[model samples]
Target: MDLLRDVLKGQSAKVFFSVFMALIFANPALASGLASGTSELTAFKDWVWTLTGIFVFLFIIVQAVRAMMDQITWLEFALSIVKVVVVGGCITVVTWAMGVFGVAP
Candidate 1:
């Protein structure tokens, strides 16, 4: 019974080591095969713009509630507009670049 348990444990360890090595070898190959240039940069830019838009929208809503509409500062309004424009512009640019480069999946 003890020998059987040891054999089972050794088999499990071997299987685990095989899986770990396979993942280690596969990761670099996958990363190297991906698009690296403008595609990657544009993806990062779009994510930043999306997060900024969400933050600005939430801030505007909170400020509008905290202060009366007339008392709200122009800076806040300008920031909100800028966030919207940035997000929209990023989406447009990424879409155009993807089409122009034929980078679709």
Candidate 2:
């Protein structure tokens, strides 16, 4: 907690980022621990897919409400649609690639 407080209240952002970068780059034990947890990580990947679907559903609902309330411009709505489509397409590609790689989803 003290370390976090010191980092947050530090005079320079550079100091904080440097410390963060150092920890991530210099941490071999952390990487090894994660590597050993690959089987457990598969469970979290399933949760990630569920959360992604929920996020897309919620985003569409919010956009629909905002549109009905006349809160968003047509251009913004169009852009939002494009962004959602792109994300969906990416997910589809990843799913396809996983199938091709014979990864059990």
lDDT of 1 at 47: 100
Model number with the top lDDT = 2
User: Model 1 Cα displacement at 40 (Å)?
Assistant: 21
Worst 10 residues of 2 by lDDT: 28-37
List where candidate 1 sits over 4 angstroms from the true fold. Answer: 1-57, 66-72
Q: Which candidate ranks first by TM-score, i.e. highest?
A: 2
lDDT of 2 by residue, 23-48 (tens): 86786644567665575577788898
Q: After superposition, how far is residue 26 of candidate 1 from its true place, in Å?
A: 17
lDDT of 1 at 55: 86
Give TM-scores for every candidate, taking all chains together and pairing residue i with residue i. 0.36, 0.49
Clashes of each: 0, 0
- The TM-score measured for candidate 1 stands at 0.36
> How well is each residue in 27-103 modelled by candidate 1, as lDDT tens digits?
76434544654466678888987897788778768766645556667677667668767877887899899989999
